[model samples]
Target: MSDINISKLDAASADFDRKLQKLLAWNEADDRHIQQTVLDIIADVRTKGDKAVIDYTNRFDQRHISAAGELELPGEILKSAWESLPAEQAQALQIAAKRIRAYAERQKIESWQYTEVDGTLLGQKITPLDRAGLYVPGGKAAYPSSVLMNAVPAKVAGVGELIMVVPAPKGETNQLVLAAAYLAGVDRAFAVGGAQAIAALAYGTETIPAVAKIVGPGNIYVATAKKFVFGRVGIDMIAGPSEILIICDGGTNADWIAMDLFSQAEHDENAQAILISQDESFLKAVEQSIHKLLPQMERARIISASLSARGALIKVNNLNEAVDIANIIAPEHLELSVEDPEILGKNIRHAGAIFMGRYTAEVIGDYCAGPNHVLPTSGTARFSSPLGVYDFQKRSSLINCSQTGAETLGKTASLLARGESLTAHARSAEYRLKA
Candidate 1:
């Protein structure tokens, strides 16, 4: 929002990264203190079951549900929600489901068993987790996109059952999200949300069965709870605030660039929006555009705070440096607003999903980018990947061997087993060889 010079802006950008690095230097989610904490929650939920879940829901949600059965949303409500939605809205959800389902089907891995050397056979049989729980945020922000993104993949992966949970913030859930859930083929859905829903999903209640995995986006408490319950049941990732990075050339329109940055900034106060450019004049124009465009937004105060705090306009040494920095940051979303988006795209290695050209804004990725908007954030992109059909599927190794093959395989196995000093393993292999 300020008309700062390039030098000051760069210094500010450097400071932001330095502070961010310090804040996240240690991944405390894995620290022993926190590690045992999640385990305790999982244990309490697992053993006490419905009572513990109700206690947690009351304690965390600050709402009084009469009992455990009250947590699960009724099928009629979801069905009514589906029927009540505008025909166009319903159709749109169906269309999104179609695209996601088709894509997810293509991503699905079939059960394969193949013969290998020595006549031994080994392959992988891909199957879906029996049950999955999806958490959709509620209140002013209800993401229908999340339903399609999280459920369709699991559906395509052949998951036997899909359950969704969303906070009925203000004592009510959004019909749009519920409609989307129906379209996505969810087996069950509930009004219970927040950490309590996650706890219930990880550890079943009397009414709601525990799920094999949990996916979708939520607030900090939900995210922290997901981190806690991870080992008990699978979770997509430890998600953080949303972010978007753009590398722009001098040729693009400055107004478009500013609004694009605002799109991500408006997501949350903590969300980040950054622009790196080789041309200094273009960067200044973009900054000016951001200032001019600030007043036009209904959420001007929020956007300005985000821009001033987390957003930046950086002057890079060259396009190469921009790409290198982009990879290092490993942003959740990266856009090349440059002349040749494809050229810059090749240099990128660490990003959840990339958008080429100024026209492909990060907002598109949020709604219709055809990629899971549920991406790893807070630099987790370095190791984690975006949510996909693979997240919902489990792969099991297949091994079959003829008697001759077993004898030959066992001989090699015995030698390696002895090297590791596993006596039982060595004896087993030797016995197989002799047999």
Candidate 2:
């Protein structure tokens, strides 16, 4: 194999920031045409109900189902899928499910209230969504991990019903995905996908029930449809390609670093894996290690393409410089593979998920590290976060005013209402005050 020539940049260079910006820029404008297509599909589902879902499933997934009822899988099928799994696979699934559930349990929100001296009760009441739609990528690439990540949290949040949609191209379905659904406590599983599936979930068909929110990752069409139906139904996030930014202090193994970079790159041609270090020699060594290891990877072509297109081997004056650059990028995954990762991690302000220390491989976090792998990407870690039980829960403010409390608060409310020229509101407050 030829030597991989990923982009090289020095943090001290004058044009470093400009070059970095260019690298980070993803052209979302090019997909404007998909919006109209998604809107049309959403309208079709809304109008024709189950019939539209059937038509789209038949056309896109090459299925022969004539009735919408056929799209919904039986609960027994999900249970059987779990039962038929090999012992190792089932054990792994159970282990991962247990860990994920344990973590999600910690994130569950509880209702709370307190009464004030004036007998005014104000607090928050927490409740889970009535139903949630989980989209799992099906077809050739099955993400059983995704099913676990998206479903377990909703279940932990006490969501009443969970509906899952996965594309079964040519009437084929993935058993592991099905098993995952069973293990995650999904109420219903459907063999449908793409923008049509999202639309059906957003706007309830006769067969498929509308959900309060939708959460999962999919192709651009699925993402576009999610964006269009966002107001009608909540979506977890409009995710971008996977990303990982590793900061090494020239202390870890070069081969380990190379494999870590390859982990995200093998995800797709657009996925990014960058390594930052203060030791220029270490960077060169890691690049050599990448060249040696790329030939052995199963997805070498994809890894090569991603590395060539978006991956980088960056050099900085010191570890502090690396942290500063990391904050600017706000990667989906940041690995502090340093001597004292905990100390270095204190400075990290952004990153969807941080894999601290050299021993914590990012792959573990993707599967069984007890955290949701559904993370923000394309530099969105600057604001967003990883998926959790909180996403499936809602908080409603509680306000109960006693007679004395109402009269005491009424004067302030009247003043504010009158200041805003809301005479009706002022009069309403005045009426409460007098009574």
Among these predictions, the greatest lDDT belongs to 2
Clashes of 1: 0
The per-prediction CA RMSD against the true structure, in angstroms, equals 3.3, 1.0
Worst 10 residues of 1 by lDDT: 3-12
What would the per-residue lDDT of candidate 1 be over residues 152-221, giving only the tens digit for each residue? 8988888899988887754677989988887778888877776767888988878778899999888766
Listed in order, each prediction's TM-score against the native is: 0.90, 0.98
- Per-residue lDDT of candidate 2, residues 96-215 (tens digit): 999999999999989999999988999999999999999998899989999999999999999999999999999999999999999999999999999999999998999999999999
Stretches of model 2 off by over 4 angstroms after superposition: 1-3
Alpha-carbon local distance difference test for all models: 0.79, 0.94
